[model samples]
Target: VTKPYRLRELIARIRAVLRRSGSEPANDVIMSIGEFRIDTIRRSVVRDGVELELSRKEFDLLALFASRLGQVVTRDECLDEIWWGRDLADTRTLDTHVKRLRQKLEADPSNPIHLLTIRGVGFRLDP
Candidate 1:
């Protein structure tokens, strides 16, 4: 019975109903990518026994990529997800965050293997 319904809103409603009905939704709170492990429940990421400290937005950014795995996350999609669909004054924020994330996660930020850029497209996490 949905004519003009957003998928996100519908999913949220479904989850709420399932919780109230004592039927929990099957959501994997933990995810792994190569040596890095993300725990959505604790909001933490650890790689090779070392805990990587990340800001809220940074974690969100990484989580988005992790969820998609080896897919090319488009610039528009990244901006929408990370910035909450708000148009920012400066669009370099995403690039800055990606740089910081590479520095923290990759062995070499200059030649990043994991967080590789897709040129005119966007970025792909080679997990």
Candidate 2:
């Protein structure tokens, strides 16, 4: 039982939140590394001018790594942030997501250029 104006206002607020959350205010939310570009707002990744499909987890994982942009993000950190503390006692979920992210973002998944593993520590994104 909401008024028309109230409904309109609610919609406006929702749209604003969506816009703010999906895009970075300073940049275009389109992070580029070499030939790879990740659009945070669109949740899309493009490599060599070709678009690649990614799952929700893949997109979130990439976004987290891109946001760090050179800092190491530990598996526990990722689980806490991305999974929102949802009982990820096992690190395999993080590994799987990282693997998927690497396959999509890296030119060579075996010798990744963007996503680097820190071994016994965590993962880092190399600009």
Candidate 3:
């Protein structure tokens, strides 16, 4: 619950968890980096005024980053929070999700300027 991402999905996931336990969503506006804006309450990602479709994991991944924009979110923390204590044997899931997020969130996913990998450390989102 301590791992809030800079993505758009975390708010919903966190909100859902919280609601299940009799709580409320922390806030709204998951992402607002450059041309893209993610509204957590609406669960919508708008880029250049057009709404984009995102999977649950993709939304959650982006939301995680949104909560902690500009900060590097560790891989383990991502897996633990997003995957929810699932098996940590494979990290390719995280990589794949990030790649997909870049594709939708970045103007040029090939050379991303927003979502970035911090080499061996983790990933950081540049606003």
Estimate candidate 2's alpha-carbon lDDT, on a 0 to 1 scale: 0.77
How would you encode candidate 3's per-residue C-alpha lDDT over 3-111 as one tens digit per residue?
6444445554575477446643564445577778888878788889999899999988888787778999898768867886456577898999999888988888999
For model 1, residues 3-122, the per-residue Cα lDDT tens digits are 776565555456545544674335657888899988987999999989999988889889878877899999867776766455566878988998898899999889998988898888
Candidate 1 lands at a TM-score of 0.77
- Give the lDDT ranking, best first: 1, 3, 2
lDDT of 3: 0.79
Position 98, candidate 1: lDDT: 85
Clashing pairs in 2: none
Ranking by TM-score: 1, 3, 2
Model 2 TM? 0.75
Question: lDDT tens digits, residues 70-125, model 2?
Answer: 89988766765666545656788889889988887777899987799999889998
**Candidate 2 residue 1 C-alpha distance from true site, Å:** 26
Flag the better candidate by lDDT, 2 or 3. 3
